[model samples]
Target chain A: MKITCPSFKYWYPRLKSGKLAANDEQLAINHLSTCEKCRKAANAIEALIEDKIQPESDVFFSARLFARLEKSKPSHSVFIFRPVFAYTLLLSLSLFLGIRLGTYFYYQSSIPSENISISEEYAIHSTISGLDVFFQDDFNE
Target chain B: MDENEKFLDKLQSGDQQAFRILVEKYQPMIQAIGIQMFERSEDNEDFIQEVFIKIYHALPNFRRKSSLSTWIYRVALNHALNLNRKNKWKKWLMNGLNLIGSNEQAVPQMPGQIEENAEQREMRRLLNKAIQRLPENQRIAFVMTRIDGLSYAEVAEVMGISEAAVDSLTQRARQNLRKHLSTYYKSL
Candidate 1:
């Protein structure tokens, strides 16, 4: 049904098999009437498609697939990818890590910087301010 | 999202009902590919089931950036080709072991084949042999474009090749098959 010669030639099997509907099939036949190249290509591969379509598989085919699914469905994937379980796991993990990190950091900071003695803070600030003044004086000089 | 995207979410999460739907939808396509790709096998149904099982396991790993059916085709074709290659190696090893003659191919006598007349059977056997002898790329191109009823563009998408490349490959595949059949007729 494609416009190109390649497409036409490739579609020969479908045409020969009459799987194409009447209208489309007629159109293909019309085109093939004038197209010796397509006809030649079709004649070459006629043997391949001449075989009857492999019979419709027995009705139990889907049943067998489902039966196999019951036996072969890997459980861990179902459990792990279960939407509710996955979301709950992620949420719980984040909460657990958040609480643990918050507590650990709080404990590590028992001597919080805000708790520095006023006198020590004043001394640290004075030293920093003095260094800034020194750097300014050097730049100016 | 589209129907397939929604269905894909379920498939990726290992939803059984969704998997069943997928099996129903794709088994026919895979079956067609199997018929076109190799000689009839006793385990043809099993091969399709194996493809489904592989698709199930591989869903998580499959990226959805492109069309899912294209990916499925690629998976089906790749699996079929790999199985064919392995079978060839096995057949060769059997031959090497002096278990079978060179001309004595493993022309499987499946149920459908049982009904074929001798002339039809001979034609099928010759076609199968010639197709199997085609270079891998040509064989894939031939199966997809010629037998599977996929357009060259569709095959290109599945194969990750340019449409021009697909066209060339298909032309070459047809030419090679023509040569193969011609040689046989010439022998007669």
Candidate 2:
């Protein structure tokens, strides 16, 4: 239906598209009345558009859909077993233990260093010095 | 509350009856979309179910920004587009299977009304396949505007595109359909 008529070509696309402007509508309708080719073309286009084959949903579609939807919702057991919840619990447990162990180790490391009195320090040095002297004397002998 | 607002309230409150009513209301529209947007073999209760399932989940987030049906169409159109993109491979697979063996079932010639309905369904299936060959936007625009008989503005609203854009799409669609459909349209 590619008529060389400028107006036909101009309006054909719009006519087929169902978007012909108000002004062009009357012109198209009048042209369509006179031009058998464009009319046949229009009829063919209409048939193609109107060849409706809408498939209906089966009777049980809703039942299957709702069943699937019910399955998709999280259950209490599923919530407890979720990876995020499991990982968070593990991380919290690890963090608590890490803090407690870190504190214990920190205190253990610092206790003697901070709490040793001058006398205790002197005693330790003197003990080391005596051992050094004893070893030195034994080596000399 | 108005009908939609009240319906939205029931939906948000997890009312099963409200959901059922909604699904029943929109089944035909979604089915019409599925027929055009999906392959004959690809469209099933599951496809519609997937769409309605999406709608079900998203209902909680519905802002009433547009009418629920408009929003549902938007969602369905998006889903169909996405699935069709992914289904390019499925088409090839189906074609391969078809080549291996066409498993068309023989229909018994029943009485008048049943046989007529079957004939109608067969015609629709072939037409759907023809429409499926169209590019995504063109196919949707063509279906929404022509087959669905939606106004260009209404289609624009559903597609979230401009009316001018819808016009261009539909024009191209009509031209393309006219070209391809020249023989088949006459035969049908």
The lDDT values for all models are 0.70, 0.68
Q: Candidate 2 overall Cα lDDT vs. reference?
A: 0.68
**Chain A TM-score per candidate?**
0.30, 0.35
In model 1, which residue pairs have backbone atoms overlapping below 3 Å? none
RMSD of 1: 15.0
**DockQ scores of all models, one per candidate:** 0.08, 0.16
lDDT of 2 by residue, B1-188 (tens): 68778889999888999999988878877766765676544454566788988888888898888988789888888888888777778757878878535634232221122446543455445455666688888898877775344567888988889999998887777676655544443333
Model 1 chain B is weakest, by summed lDDT over 10 consecutive residues, at B179-188
Candidate 1 lDDT tens digits, A63-110? 887788779965676786788889999999999999989966765665
Model 2 ranges off by over 4 Å: A1-46, A52-60, A78-141, B93-126, B147-149, B183-188
Candidate with top lDDT is 1
**In TM-score terms, which candidate is top?**
1
